[model samples]
Target: MVIVSVVGGISLLLLVFLWSIKRGQKTVRAFVFLSAVADGNSVESANELAKRIDLFAASELQKKAMIMVEMVFGGSQLKLISHARREGFDQ
Candidate 1:
């Protein structure tokens, strides 16, 4: 029973890890697509965005990517701008 529970817990954790990676990839792709649109270039595809996301998903910019993804998808830009102002990003 103990061994089974241990194995189940580990399996759950692994599933969660894989889910997070997939979610992060989706967020990164959305961010890239939005950025490309804002830059007036409509040539990017889903595969290209996926490749870019994979490249940065495990890098040091993961945190930044998460922040941007949240800002864009969560509609937190105004809040973030206010927070940044208070935190001195304006400086």
Candidate 2:
């Protein structure tokens, strides 16, 4: 009986640890997605990955952060494009 209880406890602990890792990865994915959005890159993969991972961020905060990141990304993209165009490397 004691041996069985020990095994069950270890199993439960392992499950909890796995869950935490999944949750943490979700948060990291969201942050990465936000960055991609900010730059306005076609981040289909990152977006899908972030969506696949489950996170606990409030919808409002997530949306705002995404928008903010998107704006930053868009700004940088424009600057680079302008610079490239001026340098005669338009593509």
Candidate 3:
């Protein structure tokens, strides 16, 4: 009985850990999407991007979320900008 309970507890913890990882991956993907929005010329101003970020981010995490989005964008700025330019030219 005790062994069974221990196994069950460990299984529950593993499941919770897996769920948390999945949630984190989703958040990262959202940050990447926001990064693309930030880099795109379609947004007229930083304020507009901020508003969109505010909508996507939780109130408490707005600043951190913005930083992450910026990091994703800034880190890939060359590639992203080139891709954007290429798309624009193609269009």
Can you give the lDDT of residue 37 in candidate 3? 54
The residue-by-residue lDDT of candidate 2 on 8-75, one tens digit each, is 99999999998865544443455555555556655565465455544454332455544543665463
User: Order of candidates by TM-score, top first?
Assistant: 1, 2, 3
Task: Note the clash tally of each candidate.
Answer: 0, 5, 0
Query: What is residue 37's positional error in candidate 3, in angstroms?
Result: 1.2
Go through the candidates in order and give the C-alpha RMSD of each one to the true structure. 9.7, 14.1, 12.1
Q: Please identify model 3 stretches exceeding 4 Å from their true place.
A: 41-91
TM-score-better candidate, 1 vs 3: 1
RMSD (CA, Å), candidate 1 to true, equals 9.7
lDDT of 1 at 29: 52
Cα-based lDDT at residue 15, candidate 2:
100
Angstrom error at residue 67, model 1: 3.2
Best by lDDT: 1
Residue 21, model 3: Cα distance from true site in angstroms: 0.8
Span of 10 residues, lowest total lDDT, candidate 2: 82-91
Total clashes in model 3, counting residue pairs 3 or more apart in sequence or in different chains: 0
Looking at model 2, residue 70 earns an lDDT score of: 60
